[model samples]
Target: MIRRLARFRQRFGIAGRKVAVRTELAWYWRWLGILVILAAAFALAAWMYETGRRFAGFDQRELQQQIRELERQNGRVRDELKGTREELESLRAATAASESRLAIERSAQHKLAQQIKLLERENARLREELATFESLLASEARVSKPLSIHRLTVQPDVLPGEYRYRLLLLTGTGRREQQFQGRLELVVSLTEGGKDAMMVIPEATGDAAPAFRLSFKYFHRVEGSFRVSPKAKVKGVQVRVYEGKAAQARATADATIE
Candidate 1:
């Protein structure tokens, strides 16, 4: 019986040792699991920090580029504004100069118009005086006792070679007159005892005044022998306007060689 009790005690001691070893192993396993979870959490936090830093750098670069573009745009806008101001200034100056020129021209034209008006008034006055004198002469019912002229001078100093003598006879009331009925008569005799006489140059028909109009406008072509005279007192020009028996000569132009 004693021997059996000894064996039972040995067995109990071995079983108690086994249970203590198992408890130690369970505590070690629990500590290892806690360490692995802590390591995983730390690694995740580091990765998150790196990723956030990279993202912040990218955002900063983009913001800097946008700022540069805005600054460039501002500079361009300023330059454009300056150019527009200069253009406006030039336009203003041109406009002012044009207005000044226009004003000066207008002033000059006003003065010219005033002078023209005065000259017109003077011309009208002279015309009125001439009309008055003609009316006075016409009112006097003087008998048309053929007006007559004895001598007429064409030129005191004559030029050399074959010269021309245009005789002009002007008379009558100032109006477009066509009062001539017959032919004109004139005896052109030179101081050299040479007589060159002609009634009128027939080809000068267009030059004749409209009918009886008082005008001495006529063209006469006389050649050398009759006109080229060096004689001291050249020719006596006689112009008779009316052709009737009662002869009235308006005037005559005579030439003298000095």
Candidate 2:
């Protein structure tokens, strides 16, 4: 009985053991508290980082504004560069067109110059013929030959080994009313293979015989071309006129090639 009483006192007495009284929280409230603590820690860390950046003379907002401005400037520069390239291409195309026009103009000018030269040569020839006619009229007595050749010219033609000949044939004034019928011949003197040679144009039995036939009155102009061996160099040419089937030449003219 004494032991049981001592045990009860020890169990219920103030000196036995201290007891803590606590209020129980709901599960949602506990979760809300934990979330608030985490939010506060993140806010404190962010604030510290922002303060450190400010102390180091760095501002995120200002840097971002600078980056945006630089991007705008870069876009403008690219546009300017593209415009410059387009202008360069346009200039190149215009230059090319101008060059082409210049070339065409040059070609036209060259052809015009050639035509002017030809006209000048024709004028000079006409003057020479006029002078010859005037002299013939002035000295009728000196022209004893019934038939004559004047201003015979032989020159190289455009092609190699080709030659062109021009001559004026005149009948005596006494025979002006009568038409003359004759044939023409050319004798070419040349040097071939280190030897002097002579060749006749319109060889006998050749198809060019009709071209040599002549029927004219008073005056006639004869112009023709002939070809020879390319290897031969012409030294001189002689023109002969024969009346009817006569073997002897009635009039002859000679021209030398230099």
Candidate 3:
């Protein structure tokens, strides 16, 4: 190795009287080169680490932004859900109220139907009672022998000189429900020329027939109108019912004219 140095120094024109070769210096140079490579490697590793950290920080910020946006959307969804639930509750309340009203109406209808049925039953019972009373009265009437002039009425009519009369005759059980024919006469008293006068209804009306006729088993009603002199005022009425001739058995009814 000394010979190699001596030749290298001679070739480089660095010959000395005594040239010394340093083995230790060679070792130190080798160690220095290794240290320089290690420093470069360390610098490269540091740069890679800083770049990685910057990229990781950027990605983390983006992820945080996305998380915030997602949270806002979730909040809106929750609000909508709450509103829907509230509306549903309101609908349920309305439905419940309607159902309650419907139930009440149904109950009222049922009660009305019951009331109607009761009224119908009452009406039927009343009709049956009326029939029974009529039959009993008819039987009692058959057992009695009586005759009567039941009612008489007299009144002025529409025309100035006209008057009206009504008469009723009732016959009892003596006839045994047999029909009897009769004739009626009305005698009317009136003021004529400021003096009293009497007139028969048929004569006053100028009717050729002298009397009105009637026939009934139980009762008979007779009504008629007559006209007198226009200046005459009516005062009284007398009604007579004869079974045959005017002289035969008769019933009489009388009334004051008004």
Candidate 4:
């Protein structure tokens, strides 16, 4: 190795070689070459850095383009987010309105039910009151002769005085009785001058009824009445009540006549 360096120095015209080469002189030359290359690379890097600084504002258009793209994307995202929020709020409001309407309907239904119940109660009460009134009326109904006589002119009387009479039959039945129609028999007897006197049968006879349909529980049950002129001064009278051609339900002993 030393011989090789000596030979190299002699060739290079260095009597004493300041930098000696190793025995592997090829390897050393390559390493030295690499170092020189590295120094050249550093110089190039510095030159490039200085040149780029001088042209610093040249890429403004590209930067603006990138900024515009980003801004567009941001705007699109904001619009979409705002629309979504609005839709959600509208849905919430609709739901609230529906719920409020449902509540109102429920309240109305409850009130209607209450009103129906009240009406039913009132109707029932009214029906009961009407029934009570009807019962009272039925109980109080009785037969009455509120001046049941009418003066009728006839063709003849005792010595020749013609007189006629009209008999009206009124029923005093309670409210419980239904109206009826049938025959009625009213017997006519007489007493003259406050004494028992036989009434002479008149030449003409009036209408006579075998029986009468007397409403048992009505206000006015007029069975019927017979008109007769006995041509006697008899003033005493009597009356009897029967049902369905059977035994007497009521009998009148006697009554003073006017």
Give the top-scoring candidate (lDDT): 2
Q: After superposition, how far is residue 36 of candidate 2 from its true place, in Å?
A: 3.4
Q: Candidate 3 residues 1-258, lDDT tens each?
A: 999987878877656466689666587889999999999999999888877877777455677898999999999999999999999999999999999999999999999999999999978965865664456447654356355664466888899988877655667667746788767777778898879999875553432353486767866556688788889988888876667554554766779866
Using TM-score as the measure, which candidate wins? 2
Candidate 1's TM-score reads 0.32
| Model 1, position 128: C-alpha lDDT score | 62
- Candidate 4 lowest-lDDT run of ten: 145-154
- Clashing residue pairs in candidate 3, if any? none
Residue lDDT tens for model 1, 6-51: 7787777655345444445687788899999999999999878767
Tens digits of per-residue lDDT, candidate 4, 54-146, equal 588545566788899999999999999999999999999999999999999999999999999999998996686566546544543233321
Off by over 4 Å in 4: 1-68, 141-258
Worst 10 residues of 3 by lDDT: 202-211
2 or 4, which is superior by lDDT? 2
Candidate 3 matches the true fold with a TM-score of 0.41
Query: In model 1, which residue pairs have backbone atoms overlapping below 3 Å?
Result: 147-248, 153-254, 154-253, 154-254, 177-213, 178-211, 178-212, 179-212, 180-212
Which residue pairs overlap in candidate 2's backbone? Answer: none
Q: For each candidate, what is the lDDT?
A: 0.52, 0.90, 0.74, 0.51
Better of 1 and 3 by lDDT: 3
